[model samples]
Target: MLVTGGLGFVGSHVCVALAEAGYDIVALDNLANARLSVLARLREIAGRRISFVRADVRDGRALAQVFRRRPVAAVLHFAGLKAVHESVAQPLEYYDTNVGGTLTLLRAMRQHDVRRLVFSSSCTVYGAPESLPLTETHPLRPANPYGRTKMIAEGLIADCAAAWPELKYALLRYFNPVGAHPSGRIGEDPLGVPNNLFPYIAQVAVGRRAKLNVWGGDYDTQDGTGVRDYIHVMDLAAGHVAALARLESQPESFTVNLGTGRGYSVLEVVKTFERVCGRPIPYEIRERRAGDLAQSWADATLAERLLGWRARYGLEDMCRDAWRWQSLNPDGYPERPVSAAETRRRRSRRRS
Candidate 1:
């Protein structure tokens, strides 16, 4: 198995799942938004070294080299720019990385005669929901560049599958993925400010941030704040394993939503984290983020039926596991090594 962006939050968790499933894994990452330190943690938890290739998926040569070096049964593509607001500001970069990287990876798979792919897709492709509890049949109406890129990549995969009848693929559309691995050894560690609510709350609980920003307190939800279906990262990782298993067994291609069929308001999540950590999470209600939905969950029945997969962890578990990770890793991942001169400069400033 070859996993692109294998060092990232979701990718790293899925790597653990893949390893436990007895797959010989080669993790390909550019460290664009991930840490090389994660490889050590993965090894610690997985009980073996996972092969790694530090190369961008968008680089055709690097991808081709990976395929040529060894035999890959399938490819799990997770490399891409994921921030919605960042995508809005730099649509070209998103297109270049997300769409272009998928295209490059597919080409490499084709060249290598690798026929299976499990793609990392997002529910943002559904846009503002016309209905609650979105199903696989929900219309593709992406509201932002990040979502559009994913939608486009999904199309590309479908089109490739149509052209190559031998190809089998799984497009996993995820809602908000939260929490950490149960061990808390490996978990979501965003580089800067977190783009998702769960990590932001955890950061505040850990004193990494001053307070939580609860966007939109005037919505039509239970708490008048945004509500989303938050699934544990472990469950989401298991979904990937299930999808890969199905693709290996079946010839047909499919798409499914990986989420709990429920929603939690922002205030609810903050309170839950506070209770778990035994710390008060200070928060402020701000203007609703543009393109923010009042509420959206998932109808994950298809996943349960098709892949025999259902989310096991609920909101409390999500918060508990996330707090474990956050409390343990108060500074998130460790920083990259700095120059000796830079270290001395820091010490000199302290002395002065």
Candidate 2:
């Protein structure tokens, strides 16, 4: 198996699950929003070596060389810019990296004769969802550039599958992925300010930030805050493994939603985190975010039926496990220290 963005938050967890399932992995990542130290942490957690390549998914030549060096049974596509607000600011980068990158990867897979792919998609495809408990057959209408890229990528996969009848693909549309590896070794460590709720809250609890700003509290939900389906990171990882198994066994393309089928409001999450961490999470209600939906959960019946997978962790579990990782690594991961020679060279330049 090959995992793009394997060094990232969800991808790393998926790699751990794949390792536990007895699969040798070749992970390729650009490390744009990740660190090399995670490779060591993943090795520690997997108890096995994972061959890694430091390259971007958009580099087709690099991907082809990777395929030539070793035969890959499947490709787990997880690389792309994921921040919604950031996407709103820079749509072109998102399209090039997310959509164009997938195109490059698809071409490489074709050249290498690899037929299996497990795509990491989002529930954002069902933007401004009309109803609660979103189903797999829900309409396709994304609200942001980040989500639009995913939707376009999904379409490309579908088109490729249509042309190549023998190809098998699994489009796993999941909800909000929270929490971390129970070991607390590898977790969500976004660069700069986080664009998600849990990370912001976790950082505040860890004293890295002063307070968390609740996105919207005027919504028509309990506590008047937005509601979302927050699934544990491990559960999301396990869902990917299950989807891969199904793709390997079945020779057809399919789509499924990975979520707990339950919704939690912003205030509920804060209260839960407060109880779990034994600290007050200072938050203030603010205007709604631009691309946010008031309430969006999942009808994960399709996932359960297709892959025999359903989220096993709930709200409290997510809060507790997330706090564990945040508390352990208040400052996400340490950057490599500068070498003495390099430091001296910089100092010499400054003096000159």
lDDT for each of the candidates? 0.91, 0.91
Number of clashes in model 1? 0
> Best by lDDT, which number?
1
Q: What would the TM-scores of all predictions be? A: 0.95, 0.95
lDDT of 2 by residue, 34-110 (tens): 88789999999999999998788999999999999998999999998898888999999999999998999999999
Which tens-of-lDDT digit does each residue in 1-352 have in candidate 1? 9999999999999999999999989999988788778899999999877998878898889988999989999999999999999999999999999999999999989988999999999999999998878999989999999999999999999999999989999999999999998888878888778888988999888888998888899999887998899999999999999999999888789999999999988888888888888999999999988888899999999999999999999899999999999888888778653344665798799999
Model 1 stretches astray by more than 4 angstroms: 337-352
Candidate 2 segments whose C-alpha is farther than 4 A from its true place: 336-352
Q: What is the lDDT of residue 39 in candidate 1?
A: 91
Worst 10 residues of 1 by lDDT: 335-344
